[model samples]
Target: MSAPGGNWGFRTGVNDFWGEDHGRKTIGKTILVTGGTGFIGGAALRALADSEPGTNIRVLSRQPLPESLRTGEVLHVHGDLTDPSSLRGVCEGVSTVLHLASHVGRDPELCDVVNRHGTTALLADARRHGVSRVAYMSTTAVYGHGVHRGLTETGVNPLPVSPASRSRLFAEQAVRGFGGIVLRPHLVYGVGDVWFIPTLLRLLNRVPSWIQDGAARVSVVCVDMLGEVLSGLTRIPWRGGETYHVSHPRSTSFRSIVRTVCSTLRLDLPSRSLPVAEHREISRGMMPELTDHQHELLASDHWYDSSRIWRKVRQCPGPGFSSRFARAADWYRDLLPIG
Candidate 1:
């Protein structure tokens, strides 16, 4: 659950979750963002507002957001993806639908209702409204278990172990039928990531580094870079129903990432590596719901190949990707409130 006062319990003194300028052109186009109030969704909306001034941008949020939180140029529509009928008007006059809404958890039923059923409903509405294109935000977890080194968009499903991953994969298949684009981004980290980065920090405090195979290389991309890529999808003409793995050119080692966090906080890095067998035993003992697929992720590498996406979109042409980690550290240090 979210923290009290609408805060996501983010660490005090971090300033890493703001939007950047992408300089996109939105002439005569109306775009809809499903999860505009969310971290990545908010960033996408801000980028669009900055790049294309005066464009008709609409956000479908469950709760009404304060004016200061919005782009001022955006139209806020109160709606829920769980109810397909509520999404009808939300898709009206929207030529491009960026479906970023999703539910992440261990509950398979809840995951299906939101990720699978919600996506199905959204696509139906988009098709009904005659939307020209769509960009569906998905996770690399859909690829599932084992060492996913150099995995590409077209690679075989390694193994979907978690309820979240299975539901997401099902959602991907459902959306693909509509001829829309699906992007699986791995380890999306940025300032406003209350779940991803903060969760890692918490796990670091609780668990030993050996569980994740300290040297395992994992692919990651900054939320900002993902936003830019989302914007590119709108501008670039591509075949519908294609899946792209969005990530930075290089991968980060599990140990190095943890060490970075420890160094940033002036804390000592964990030296003990939990043996694979012991790690599994401990995980099952603690999180009995831990699926076989999720276990594979912790013990093995889950990297991806982004050559196809890079070849088409061209390199981001700036330091947007590399600067994200440092920016995250800065955000955690500056914007987060101190006790």
Candidate 2:
């Protein structure tokens, strides 16, 4: 689905949706966004370009991206997160840094290098340059497995299930010491999402419906909302070493998500539910390295309390929450038949 209001046009009135003046004048500082070519990072870059023009925006990446992804006079810096020396000049003259670059997924060593080592390196450099503030993009997966009915920011019951999650938790601690704001977004989804949606669709195509009990609840946030939160981070005064959970206020059922995907793609919905235990056993055998915590995440419920975030930055007051979900589903539909 395309962005509403047609043609992905740039928005000028910052106050039109959220009733907040996030105009260029309010943004009095330069910003640097790592992983700006990625989905969520790209969204944040676009929002900043529209709302905070004239603010020096730099994107840190190892390689060049398409011209279309480059929004509004963005300066691209060629650097790898694994190399600390390369990040020296990247953070120079930048007042704020949004750390979104990390190695996610199955590779343990790579995750350690990018998520743990890379974060530490960046934080050190930011401190050296005396950057005013920083926002580190973390995942709710750090909480790890089981029902999180009303998970809050203070909660730190991280299950060391996957290498990625473990490394992120470690990185969070390091970032906290550097006076960095850590944002833990649950299940971020949107257009240009090559990770979450494609993986879910593949699982849907391969597995039976009952494997996850069809009742698990998961918290989620649209990329647009996440972008707003990231941008707001630079303005708000963050409590040193504090973490904030970023998610849509409501928790949606796993079954509902599957149904939504099927409905959007005009595909047949799965009718049978497989026994949870049996599915777990099969999955473990197939993916032996997959941590038990990660496996448990499939059938687990992780609902976050986003009240603090809402109080800090007003959500875009447009349609109801369902409208956001529909937008995500529409985006998913447009990128179909992927290999």
Candidate 3:
């Protein structure tokens, strides 16, 4: 399925979709959400708005926000991460800041500029404006490739394979000193997700092979659930530089995920197998649009241990592994053009 425009509000009635109230506790502070227009940040903002009606939110975005999300409590500010001067008043009166904007590209220099230097500039502004707390949405890709089982927060982060991941690691280093929590979520998917699942579906349309026949075990999280985790963070007693891995404790096989996706979409799975090198070369020739890093992700495992964060959030896995994705499958499918 192709990615749709960013219009994911409560229209789909998935706000309380997980069968939980999602914590009605109020933060009562003005919060600034960078990348609020994106998937994770947008979901987190909606969850926060539902849970805390009185709380005010400031959004920094380069695009026009959907009319459905621009309520009185939600304020929009124009800014770009590449332009530090444009971020002049974004942190004014904001007690908490959620750093969600980062470059997800192939260029090393641009990635560092936006992900590393951009974060550095934002945190500096937050500190200067007396922002009390901050939260960073880092990725599990920082841990690198291979069969990672039950990986911890302080677990050795191997050299990143993608330029985006490497830049995020540098950003995490800057955020470590910013006096708040860092959440590293793996394979976050749901409505409005343009990365994890949608990208795979698009690639699978062209490539007809899987690495190791897609038997690798991996960890994943629902975007709404990740948003819930972000919303609940303000209420928790977290120390500065404390990092947490975010995902279900259980891991699902990569083959099962692909099968479920195909079944849900009424599409057929690839019937042939090829060596990793041949498949990579063929896929690159077939779809020159996708980055090499994105292609590598489908072949690796990124399972992590989320027991500690799960206990603190006081939330259980919403439904069985397959059922959760099945429930949202239609939403993703709708984003694709009907063939």
Candidate 4:
């Protein structure tokens, strides 16, 4: 997870994050950023701004942006995704669009309204405005839960079960139909995370046990790298809609995830390891948010081969999870405040 001020490796300029030079393609361009104040959006917004200091940026949000994002360089556009009328002229004079806003909850109608219908309206507006390029943020959960290991972008068929995932899949389909790019990242963690870290902490707080000691290996990315990857996408010469899995080259064991979280927050580790069957019997329905399928997913392999994104952005995935986790210990401790 990447906090706003964490080390995102943008010292020299935005081009430095990409490692190689592409004439700084984003320079002086009019780019619009949706969901610019959310967790991932905030990180990506910061990186995009730092990449090209003088570029014109339009941030769309239903609520007011934080003081941190209120720099004079950015043009805040007040709009709501749920209301298509508000997005009528939002994309005008914009060269690039970064779609990051979505409804992530159990409400199916809300998800359909915000994630699916909202995106369709935005894309329609983008096409009418003659926007040059568009990029969308998606999740690997669109593939559903399984023993997925080292799967390519198109290796597995998308079988989303959750309301949020299903609506996002529809949004992805709309983006591809408009010939825009889609980026999927699995288990993104760092400073601004409110899902992965908080949910895991809740699970551990109630029950300090895992099925088979969390041996399942999963692919993950830090928020800083993820933001840079999203900002770096505008520079790629992509056409006709392409999907890429965005994560580190390496994978981490679930055991290591629990170990690191516990160590970082000074929490107790699982004292007993139970078989999957027994664990299900005891853990099921304990948390209304987590289901039996999610429990199984937590214990299975979810490694996705994301080397393509690393190559696309030309940015190093940096060190492994253990090292990266240490760097964000302070942020996690301050947020989670559990032991």
Ranking by TM-score: 4, 3, 2, 1
Q: lDDT tens string, model 4, 187-277?
A: 8888888777777787777667876879889888888888898888766655648899998889899899899888877888999888877
Clashes of 4: 5
Ordered from best to worst lDDT, the candidate numbers read 4, 3, 2, 1
Supply the TM-score for candidate 2.
0.84
Best by TM-score: 4
Q: What is the lDDT of residue 110 in candidate 3?
A: 87
lDDT of 1 by residue, 218-295 (tens): 887887777777766555556678898888868778777766766776656777778777777776655565555555
Candidate 3 lDDT, 286-310, residue by residue in tens: 8787666566667766688988888
Regions more than 4 Å wrong, model 4: 1-27, 337-339
lDDT of 3: 0.74
**Following a full C-alpha superposition, what root-mean-square deviation does model 3 have from the true structure?**
7.2
Error of 1 at 292 (Å): 5.8
Is 1 or 2 the stronger prediction by lDDT? Answer: 2
- Which runs of model 3 end up more than 4 angstroms from their true locations? 1-27, 274-278, 288-293, 335-339
Q: Between which residue pairs do clashes occur in model 3?
A: none
Query: Top model by lDDT, which number?
Result: 4
